[model samples]
Target chain A: MATKRKQRMIFVIVLISGFAAATALALFAFQKNLLYFYSPSQLSEAEVTEDQLFRLGGLVVEGSVVRMPDGITTQFSLTDMQGQVQVEYTGLLPDLFREGQGIVAQGKLNASGLFVAQEVLAKHDENYMPPEVAEALKAAGGEHPVSIPKTTVE
Target chain B: MFTFLHKYASPQYFYSWSASWQKWASIIAALLMSVGLYYSLLNSPADYQQGETVRIMYVHVPAAWLSMFGYMVMASAAIVTLIWRIKVAEIMIAQCAVIGASFTALALITGMLWGKPMWGAYWVWDARLTSELVLLFLYFGVIALSGAFDDERAGARAAAILTLVGIVNIPIIHYSVEWWNTLHQGPTVSKFDSPSAHPSMLIPLLVMALAFKAYFFAVLFKRARTELLLRERNTSWVKALLKEAV
Candidate 1:
């Protein structure tokens, strides 16, 4: 009975390790596809056709927001501090949307190398503090720590 | 230690022993939950960026933590069941499935509600969200597999194997935001050295997490006791229990 139990334990370990190895390999192969969005740097490096729909994510470049004459349409530039992409969208933005905020926009590129976005999502950082604390931080010339690195492709 | 474990491993001993602790756990859970609610809802300050909606983090984060925690418990119980063939551990796997699924559902719902205003979409195919959804499905799968067989032990063994296989998803769920370009933000409180949340907000969140943990134990003990009673209905202790009730 002891030997049987030992054999069973070994069998279970082997089964689990084998299964985990297979899954790790599969996930590794699909690593690029698993990313929700591509950085501006990745977008430039990848061979993306104008008609291909994909998500572009990065910081909304400070002072790049332009509200068109039509109230709905807005244009902005996204940057990873290494590369920048111009994005235009016609939709109501989230309340969190603002210059210097990270955001992900999904759409296709146009003929003039402009990204025409169908949807845009605001991506807030991990920092959370009260308004008073934020004011103090700003007064002290400190900024909210950015958790997501600027040029992370994965 | 072995003797102590052996004594408790007996379902009859465990059934009786768990009753007193179950009462204590529920009382503690209730007390903690009240304090947690007060701190989270009224005492905590509004976030600089998210305003009042950040209060949702108290519920959402705790539920998410419990969801993962429940799975870890189930996986540990699975190991015990498979290795020692412990009847109590087998029962634990079944109980953990239902509880884990409920927590997973709660986490997903609260996350979606929080996501709508902040992220502009109620749902997204982001890595963290997607993996959590998979976890919910994995719980459902375990529950279904455990109930499929006529012999309870056989069903439990099958469920145990499945639980072990799905254990890989837990790490994926945890590190998804860091590993992939997810819309979900990275770790906040988990960062040991430099937590991103302020003390006021962090304190409430921690209190709520403790409350959830207590609640989990309360429910687990109660459910496990009932299951033990049912499973041992033909045994002498349960027969005596029934006689005493009469």
Candidate 2:
């Protein structure tokens, strides 16, 4: 009975410890590969790898929208209302996308520090905006869409 | 009926019953999972937006659903053990904890793997993801608390209290994605409206859910039986059952 009890304790310990160790090892091995989202300003100063796809968000800087001659590719500048970074996308823009509105572009940094967007999403207007977008916008500037007048905000 | 129910409350009776049930449950579970996995992986259509990556949903959704379902089972057993002083319930509760924790870990890991290709991030603080992580922690807490006390009964009672407390978090987790503006998509299956899910998607999801539930019952039955035998090794019924098997 005593030996059986000892075995039980060892079994429980091994299960928990084994899982914990495996998870820790996996996380450590992939630590650098873990993708983190960044605002346009953070990406500017952050040392981001060229291959790491990350989220970059900001207001589409007014009148900075310029499409290249290829017709498929477009270049625009994103600003946190403090700093600006150029972003390029070759895909079709999402509906509700417009200048001066919030957008999150998913892609990685190029060697020149330009954001090469694989996917571009426009933050839907006030009532449906995601919290992360709202917080990011808020931190960048007081761009709280919910608090703004519906007519004026849009 | 009362006497029959009462008989199984003893560790000795439970040990014998669990051994018999384990084999039957295992066979049923294996059969269900085989059908479910095959249909999910091969017959289902690739998602319109996600392409082949949507196939991961078959495993991810079922695992997530089972993790929650398993916790509920464990919590219910804990309540019964506490209220009725049933040794069988205690054994079931302990066994279910191990299995539930395993399912929760599987769900979290599978979700991360799916997220990498779909969401571009393996982990996110979105409401759904965070709440699921919390659920995993809750399972770990129950398992830890159960073993914390030197006296087994004391440990069980303490763990039971923790389980009851953790039940409150489940609903919060379910609605967290909806309540707060979250990046995670809302429910496709558990909805009041005509489900946004296609027939192909829905069929595989349901099959997988049933398969996972069966698997849980099978494993829990086996583990509970082992627990009962360990606790009641000196009892006459266990001895008789052992002799017969030999």
Candidate 3:
């Protein structure tokens, strides 16, 4: 019985120590890379550097979109009704791309602190908007466009 | 609640409690899943873009969520078992491993079905995919470690250690999209600012997520109760419990 208890104690100690070590190691490695999601309003207020690859999500600002010299490249501003972010993207866009639509841009900040989007994903329908966009809009005092009607999506 | 939980730390007491919970949870799980699937498949709006592929999201996304969730549950149980020396915690760790691994496998398979048409490839070394694959291996390693030793107690302890070590990969998996230039899309629901999912898509996703959680609780209760019974078979309470069941 004494030997059995000794074994159990040793096992408990090893397992606890192992968890502590792993958690410490993980936190140390990811200290810099875990970027929190931010709105344009928050980004403007906060101390954001030009090199961070952070996420900026909201509706494509109406009438603020412009095509660059290259037809494939487009520049637009995204807004949450409170603040706005200038974004540049050069790629084939999703079919739903349009002004007043929701979009999530993934990329890094440029030397000028402007967002250089690697990808731009647009909402599929007039009624559809990303939840993040809706939340930001709600926070910015805008009402959500779509209500659950009697009809379901089948 | 703390005092209530404290009593069930003993394997013998936990076995009886879990047995009762298993029956209730299983029934609830069946009910919730039936409603969730019926509503999601037949009533939810078809995607204007992806069409039927969006349906795959109902299964794939929730399975992925549960996969990560399962690992978290297992690892947390492992931590509790080791720190508190609670036998019931070990049972929970073991039970969660089986269930979590199954969810991970489902997520991968459903993802493949969705990816073949959407991404134009069945498999790619994207950050999200790779991290998910690594998670599968971690599950396997934990499962394998549990059976390695002749002594069940020693095996459980070793597996608990492995589960703890493997949890380091969870953060890496979650942040892989941000850290690397991956083809996979970033998070849609689990952020602070805005979720990138539309209300039509978002409501179903949330409902499905809840359904999956319920299913997990149902299954884990069953497995944990069985494990407790097995581990404490020699105890007097277990014999009485078995007699009652029979």
Clashes of each: 0, 0, 6
- Candidate 2 docking class: incorrect
Quick one: best lDDT, which candidate?
1
lDDT of 1 by residue, B1-246 (tens): 646766887888888888899998899889989999999999889999999999999999999999999999999889878887888889999899999999999999999999999998999998999999999999999999999999999999999999999998999999998888899999999998989899989998998999998899899998998988988899998999999999
A-chain TM-score per prediction? 0.94, 0.58, 0.56
TM-score of each: 0.97, 0.65, 0.65
Model 3 residue B76 CA deviation in Å: 1.5
Comparing only chain B with the true structure, the TM-scores of all models are: 0.98, 0.93, 0.93
- Candidates sorted by DockQ, descending order? 1, 3, 2
Cα lDDT of model 1 by residue, A13-119, tens digit: 98688888988899899988998998898887878898999999999888999999999999999998888999999989999898888999999999999999999
Return the interface RMSD of model 3.
10.3
Model 2 clash pairs are none
Tell me the tens digit of each residue's lDDT in model 2 across B1-246: 646777876676666667667777778778878888888788766754456767777898888888888888987777665655567776666677788788888988987876665545577665577768888888888888888888777788778767766676677567654444344555667764666566667877788888788788888887777777777788888789889999
Query: Candidate 3, residues A43-134: lDDT per residue as tens digits?
Result: 67556677766666667877988998889999999876777889999987665567776665778888876799886754222233434555
Q: Distance from true position, residue A47, model 1, in Å?
A: 1.8
lDDT of 2 at B204: 74
